[model samples]
Target: MRGMTNTLTIGERVAWYRRRRGMSQDVLAGLVGRTVDWLSKVENDRIELDRLSVIKNLADALDVALGDLIAEPSLMEWVADSGTKTIPRLSAALMDYRLITPVSSPSPIAEMPSLVSLAQEVDELWQAYQASRFGYVTTLLPETLSRCQTAVEAYDSDDQVQARRLLAFTYQLAATQMTKIGEVELAWIAADRGLAAARITGDPVAIGSLLRSVAHALLAAGRFREAMQLIQDTASYLDPHLSDPSPELLAVHGTLFLTGSMAAARANDTDTTRTFLKAADESAQRIGQDANHVWTAFGPTNVAIHRVATAGELGNVQVAMDLGPRIDTSALPMERRVRHALEVARAYSSWNRTDDALSTLLAAERIGPEQVRYHFLSRQLVLTWIKRQKGRPSSTLADLAHRLKVLD
Candidate 1:
């Protein structure tokens, strides 16, 4: 098994680790409360292990880090130096409390990022994120967050409120990016910070928008029940304003419903899922057009996209296959489009349409390579395809896997 870590599939790695630990298949299987036959099929890669909870159980049984079995290549290996340094700096920025109290002498006001420039840059970063330019956003996030903190302290009255709003929005973006890359704990921290800032602004729209981030991080961390509760509570809190809602408020409310739908779907609560989806659709109809108000991308088209996604999450692949292809996603942002494409690919994979699945994945990569590269769905689908391949994978499949760093 020497040097196999870089090339072995997750199942193979599990086998290697089990053997190295002097454990039998029966012993390992019993430890994880799985049958030996199930363990055998898992080791042979006959079944793909995609669920994080199941993988965590296996890792615990094997006495390995979850990353050891997942083997996701470092972001730096694919993007560059920024990956190694970005997270720590972002953490420091998140932890810095100088804005709350003078921890040390603050940077000179002249040295701080100007409010006007910071607002513009915040919008630009959100645009970059929606366009799936994640690596670039990660590189800039630490400094931008620090600047928002500084702006809150430097300004006063209305300017301070505006600064706090920007700070909340920036933290929302950070939480979103962290969730995308599997940094769930950090994502939660960012979401908490965003919500705290939003509360200080006393803006319902700002608070509502941060609720989306908080719910998103919760979903990523598999806390579906808590996520749904938060969404429901936020929706109730914003209900009074919806009678004569601004576009921003409508978008934020609609986005909260969409997140709720996802949480319900993942929790396998069909009734709640339908209810949330219906609410999202009603909000979309009221909005009248596809728009990115409050950066929620809430509209009829986005609601449709989420319907397909929720179906996929609930194992209604037939519905996803039926709805996913007919919808024109060209009008949506690259993030939503790529995400829908990945769901379509998942539908195809589950339907055993390997060729269609691979083609869809390839097309999604062409449009958003970074998004596909870091996404768990794409990685698992590609790994399953590799396992299902007999003699050897075609050059295209091999190339994609190599580029995704699933193979050394």
Candidate 2:
């Protein structure tokens, strides 16, 4: 501490600003509407803070002020905010670099990134997720969600209906991905938030989409009755009498009923399953020609995956296996495409085809460590069956079971 009021280098100032806001470089990027790499450079004094709007956005996102952000705060502030305080040895250098920036020569500025439109950024993130590039997905998704949430908070002030809709939809997307990792509770929370926001906007399409999300969470949690009720209620809300009801809206609602039916079958309530399926099929027909509506759930591929799960549950392994090969993998994102292999594993295991089952399971595991979920349940099922057949499973399967942490 020795210049002006105290000595703080460029790195020091950047680090201080980060601390002042109690943000990590990643979180700072989220606040400032920049990428992590860019924020890191800025903190290292390798980049300049050129965007006033971004700086203001950062303050808003961090719930802080621009001047306080310039104070000589310590990295401890960030640690405190992160709900932890032990400074990692690796992080020891950020402080030193911080103290050095004000007293030493400034680090050279990095080349600025080309500005991309918000939709373009979203498109890029979606593409990365589609590729199953988990590193990129996890890295950017938080920031994207932050931006969407921030936009949602400000949507009313801007008087933009479309922007509000986008914000609500983005939350639904976050909830869907959260459920992939078995965070069903959080996913449901997000869906509820989105539902409230959609209702505020009086957007039937948005509300229907959020309802489908809630339906997915309920269906997966084995709440068949509740899921059915939700779908039925959503149908009533949609008011099919609209002169040009969106095919996208109808398709999603139809898919919700299909999900409930599948859940019902899993519960062994065949009558309920049949009833829901009949309603779903009827609604599916009302969703006419537009196959690419982001909300429409109509592709033959979507139908195939649901068919496999339902048939497998109904003890019709042959039907599931038969439909498995007909699914169009090219039409789905990696997250859902990887689910096809899960269905394959189930169908093979059901037929007592040990080798085929193992192969499918291993293949799915190889491609989808970070992309898919619920493998532990499948592994447990196979291992239990194996143990029942013999005193123990094969050594190889036993080892696999251990790796998967299953009862087998």
Candidate 3:
């Protein structure tokens, strides 16, 4: 049944679960405030279930866990791809007693890492993540978390504040990486921890940057409204500082709007999406060029990339196809480049350009194998192509599916 469920599209999964619940299409449609015709089309995959809120509604009516409908990857699958104990160790690091409890005295332990050394480690982790080296990042994250926590505990005065800033950045990295791998709950916890650490540092730039992580976590968890609200409020708070903003502030602020645009698109709020994108574009224009300050990837080119993504999310396949393929993302991080390619592939698949979609996904896989394999969109699209094939799929398609483990 697990394998069967995985092989089914989301709409097919809904139909399967409805049958298991002994409910008719009419009955399920009524439960979800829709017509029987609408339900029939949904079950037939004639309609796309792209909105999270709608998906959540369907899951609620079906009385199944959200993941049961989404076919989220299992713990064993993640471990198989990411080496043994990666998820559990990261979870353990988040739950460490030392991090959670206040220490009265400095215990006998190895000397605390210097602030410079710790900062370098944090930067390295960010670099690994941006390169889509998910396995390596996960392997190194638990120890980095512990080391940063130790630095926070050992430093004093101004140094303590700096250590806290680094700790916040580390947590933000964990949160973002967890989201990419579909660990939404763990991502939420890490985002919250990063926000807490940023608060202690009293650095508006740090706090604002971590807020983007929090927003991403919320977006991953399907809390689209909460995510957008957080972004709006943070933007308002940071507006006064933009008169003569630091590069870090500009990048963080622009990235926040970009995230809000995505959340808006996911919620099917086209007006808000446009508004957020406009603000982000204006911010980027002020910055004048592509840059990765604060690891926000906030710049003109990045804004253009988000435009392609939001267009795809909003179901404007033409717009995505027009904008996505033309953008040269070589200057951006490998993670961002791969993500844009995935969006472009989605556009191609939507337009029924399956060969082009397959080729695009193959190219992205070559660039960021971990990103493509673990990403829900890539896996789903591959499964869909396989299901649509009348006989055997093409060799390259089959190999791609095998590598993604979607055929499992």
Q: Best candidate per TM-score, number?
A: 3
Error at 67, model 3, angstroms: 3.6
Off by over 4 Å in 1: 1-43, 49-74, 77-85, 97-105
Q: Which stretches of candidate 2 lie over 4 Å from their true place?
A: 1-116, 122-139, 153-159, 241-243, 282-292, 295-297, 325-330, 372-374, 385-408
Winner on TM-score between 2 and 3 is 3
**Cα RMSD for candidate 1?**
3.5
Candidates' lDDT values, in order? 0.84, 0.56, 0.85
Better of 1 and 2 by TM-score: 1
Error of 1 at 203 (Å): 0.7
TM-score for each prediction? 0.87, 0.61, 0.93
Candidate 3: global Cα-lDDT?
0.85
TM match of model 3 to true structure:
0.93
lDDT of 3 by residue, 121-206 (tens): 99988998898888778878998888887888788999999999999999999999888877888888899999999999989899
Candidate 2 Cα deviation (angstroms), residue 26: 55
Ten-residue segment with the worst summed lDDT in candidate 2?
Answer: 72-81
**Which consecutive 10 residues in model 3 have the weakest lDDT in total?**
73-82
Candidate 3 vs. truth: CA RMSD? Answer: 2.4
lDDT at 360 for candidate 1?
A: 95
